[model samples]
Target: MSSINAQRLTVLAGPSGVGKGSVKALIQQHYPWVWLSVSATTRSPRPGETDGVDYHFVSHERFEEMIAAGEFLEWASFSGNLYGTPRGPVERQLEAGLPALLEIDLQGARQVRVSMPEAQLVFLAPPSWEELVRRLTGRGTEDAATIERRLSAAREELTAEPEFDHTIVNVSVEQAATELVELLGSPVKAAH
Candidate 1:
């Protein structure tokens, strides 16, 4: 496409275990200027993940309060837990002429599409469904039950790839990130 503006709100929504964190981390490391929106979640933290940095780990009550207050740009329940993007940070970043990035789930993405029609939706895909299953099982942090649930969720998310403006297949994290950077620059305007 079109060239993306510096203030575009870019969303990365895809199947879990498709290495989004890895790709996003690499992007941040290489391009520290990008505004990455940390999500607010009711899920417990995984090992090595911080409370506010990885996510704004909130009590279920706090999450509900935020939801009721309309603080989130979009919120969704995933795998029996809730996750949302706070409205303030992303708006401030966009206003400040920064490229704001939100790495969220598909339901949340759909919400953003409705609420912020200018936001550009990008879906990251694995090379294959088999590879996706392998990656999910390989994480090894989640128990079999949790892993299965995530995989099931992944299937649902993958079905919505066509809903996104573009998709990047994640074979190599660095290359994928580079391509993402290119895609981000190709569209000049924010999109629904």
Candidate 2:
């Protein structure tokens, strides 16, 4: 395939606590070649999140400016916070013949589908709904009401699994990372 045709802009989407971050981290550690696109968000950073690493952490006005400039490949407002994938970095990586990964939410995934139908959408699923609830509650970052809201969103996300081109159940981090790397059309190296 031509470099343009083999851009491999893969979208990894899942519910709030389905280990998408964990799997992506593992892949980055083992296969540094895969470029994971950082999203721009209007939300304030959580306890350990750093700007540019976890997200771009832009102001709402700045995000709006970017939107007006057509800078985002996909963007959506969720629970009052706006999140989006910047188009530049992903385009650069693809132009360099590198596989680009976007770890985004369901709404962003749908937007990407609309904009780039050739992009691969992968749904990372929890082993079970009970396990999903357990993981979300175990996070301890949110209040009871917030956890309930996340669970509700998760239920809706789970129902949209059929919308994805592929589904990987996150039973083990190593296994899921391997599956994700394979889906990106890259050979998995030795796991650290």
Candidate 3:
């Protein structure tokens, strides 16, 4: 297989409650130059999430339209909602010599791997299942049923860690994000 240019795309994927959001925030706060792709979702935004920031909140119709137009780099459905990475923005960022990072789920990461073999896939694991449970429950975003559902999904995601190129245990969000930035800084290989 041919290696890509030094401008690599990095994917940060982990189970729920594994601090993906915290790591993403750290990347945004500390590494302003690294561009994180904004995903489009058919799900409704939470209380404070703004359109085009947390996600490009679109109707189911619009999302289907984008899918039909082949405008997504990768798309997947999770937790009863559709999510996809927009193609145009990611290409624009990469064309401008910026590193593109996509913080998404394992399924989405897998899809990206198939489509863009050059993208670096990183898996973020929790210290323990108990710790994961504690974090998920403490977040208070989900009810018992929802928490259980997410935990189930987490289990599946954890099982697939070895499929990734690198695995980082997310015991501390700052530490994990720092490591992520380090990986981001590394030069990409044309053929890996």
Candidate 4:
């Protein structure tokens, strides 16, 4: 495989319950210096999620205002809530020569492909369709209706895996993180 530019901005995308968050967290644990952009969302905070950290929770009107002002690099509505990556923070990270990571949906990933053609897109895929269904249902957070919707969306997202520069099957968080870190060509602190 070709070496990746360490400073190149990367967008990591996958369907819900495909372990994107787990892989990202593992990467951060191994490479603390790497910067991951926190997205802004109009959705309410989940159980232990924090504002300004996990996500920048915003009101629907505020989100729309930001959209009008061209504040987001990409924005999309999912599961009845709006989610977007703030343009300023990501630009700052890239401008500072940092390896920036954006964990977003397929819609946002497509937007990044248009806005930043050089941005590397990585797709995290489940080992199998059955595994995906198991993971989604095992989450225990969503209802049957939501799970069904997510499964439908997952099927669509799976079709877009070929659109990414790389596809990593998330069988193990450590292995996936190592592969992702290698793809970024960045130094790691230590695996957690």
Cα lDDT, all candidates: 0.86, 0.89, 0.87, 0.89
lDDT of 1 by residue, 1-192 (tens): 666776788899898899888989998887766668999999999999998789999989999999899899999887688989999999998897778888887888999999898999999999999999999998778899998888888988889998999899999999888887766553233331
Tell me each candidate's TM-score.
Answer: 0.86, 0.89, 0.89, 0.91
Candidate achieving higher lDDT, 2 or 3: 2
Backbone collisions counted per model: 8, 0, 3, 0
Model 3: residue 158 alpha-carbon error in angstroms = 0.7
TM-score of decoy 4: 0.91
Residues 76-129, model 3: lDDT tens digits: 887688999998998887787778899998888999998888899989999999
Q: List the residue pairs that clash in candidate 4.
A: none
lDDT of 4 by residue, 30-56 (tens): 788778999999999999999998999
The lowest-lDDT stretch of 10 consecutive residues in candidate 1 is 183-192
Please say which candidate is ahead in lDDT: 1 or 2: 2
lDDT score of residue 97 within candidate 1: 78
TM-score for candidate 3, please give it: 0.89
Candidate 2: residue pairs that collide: none
lDDT at 174, model 3: 87
List where candidate 1 sits over 4 angstroms from the true fold.
143-145, 186-192
lDDT computed for candidate 4: 0.89
Which regions of candidate 3 deviate over 4 angstroms? Answer: 1-6, 186-192
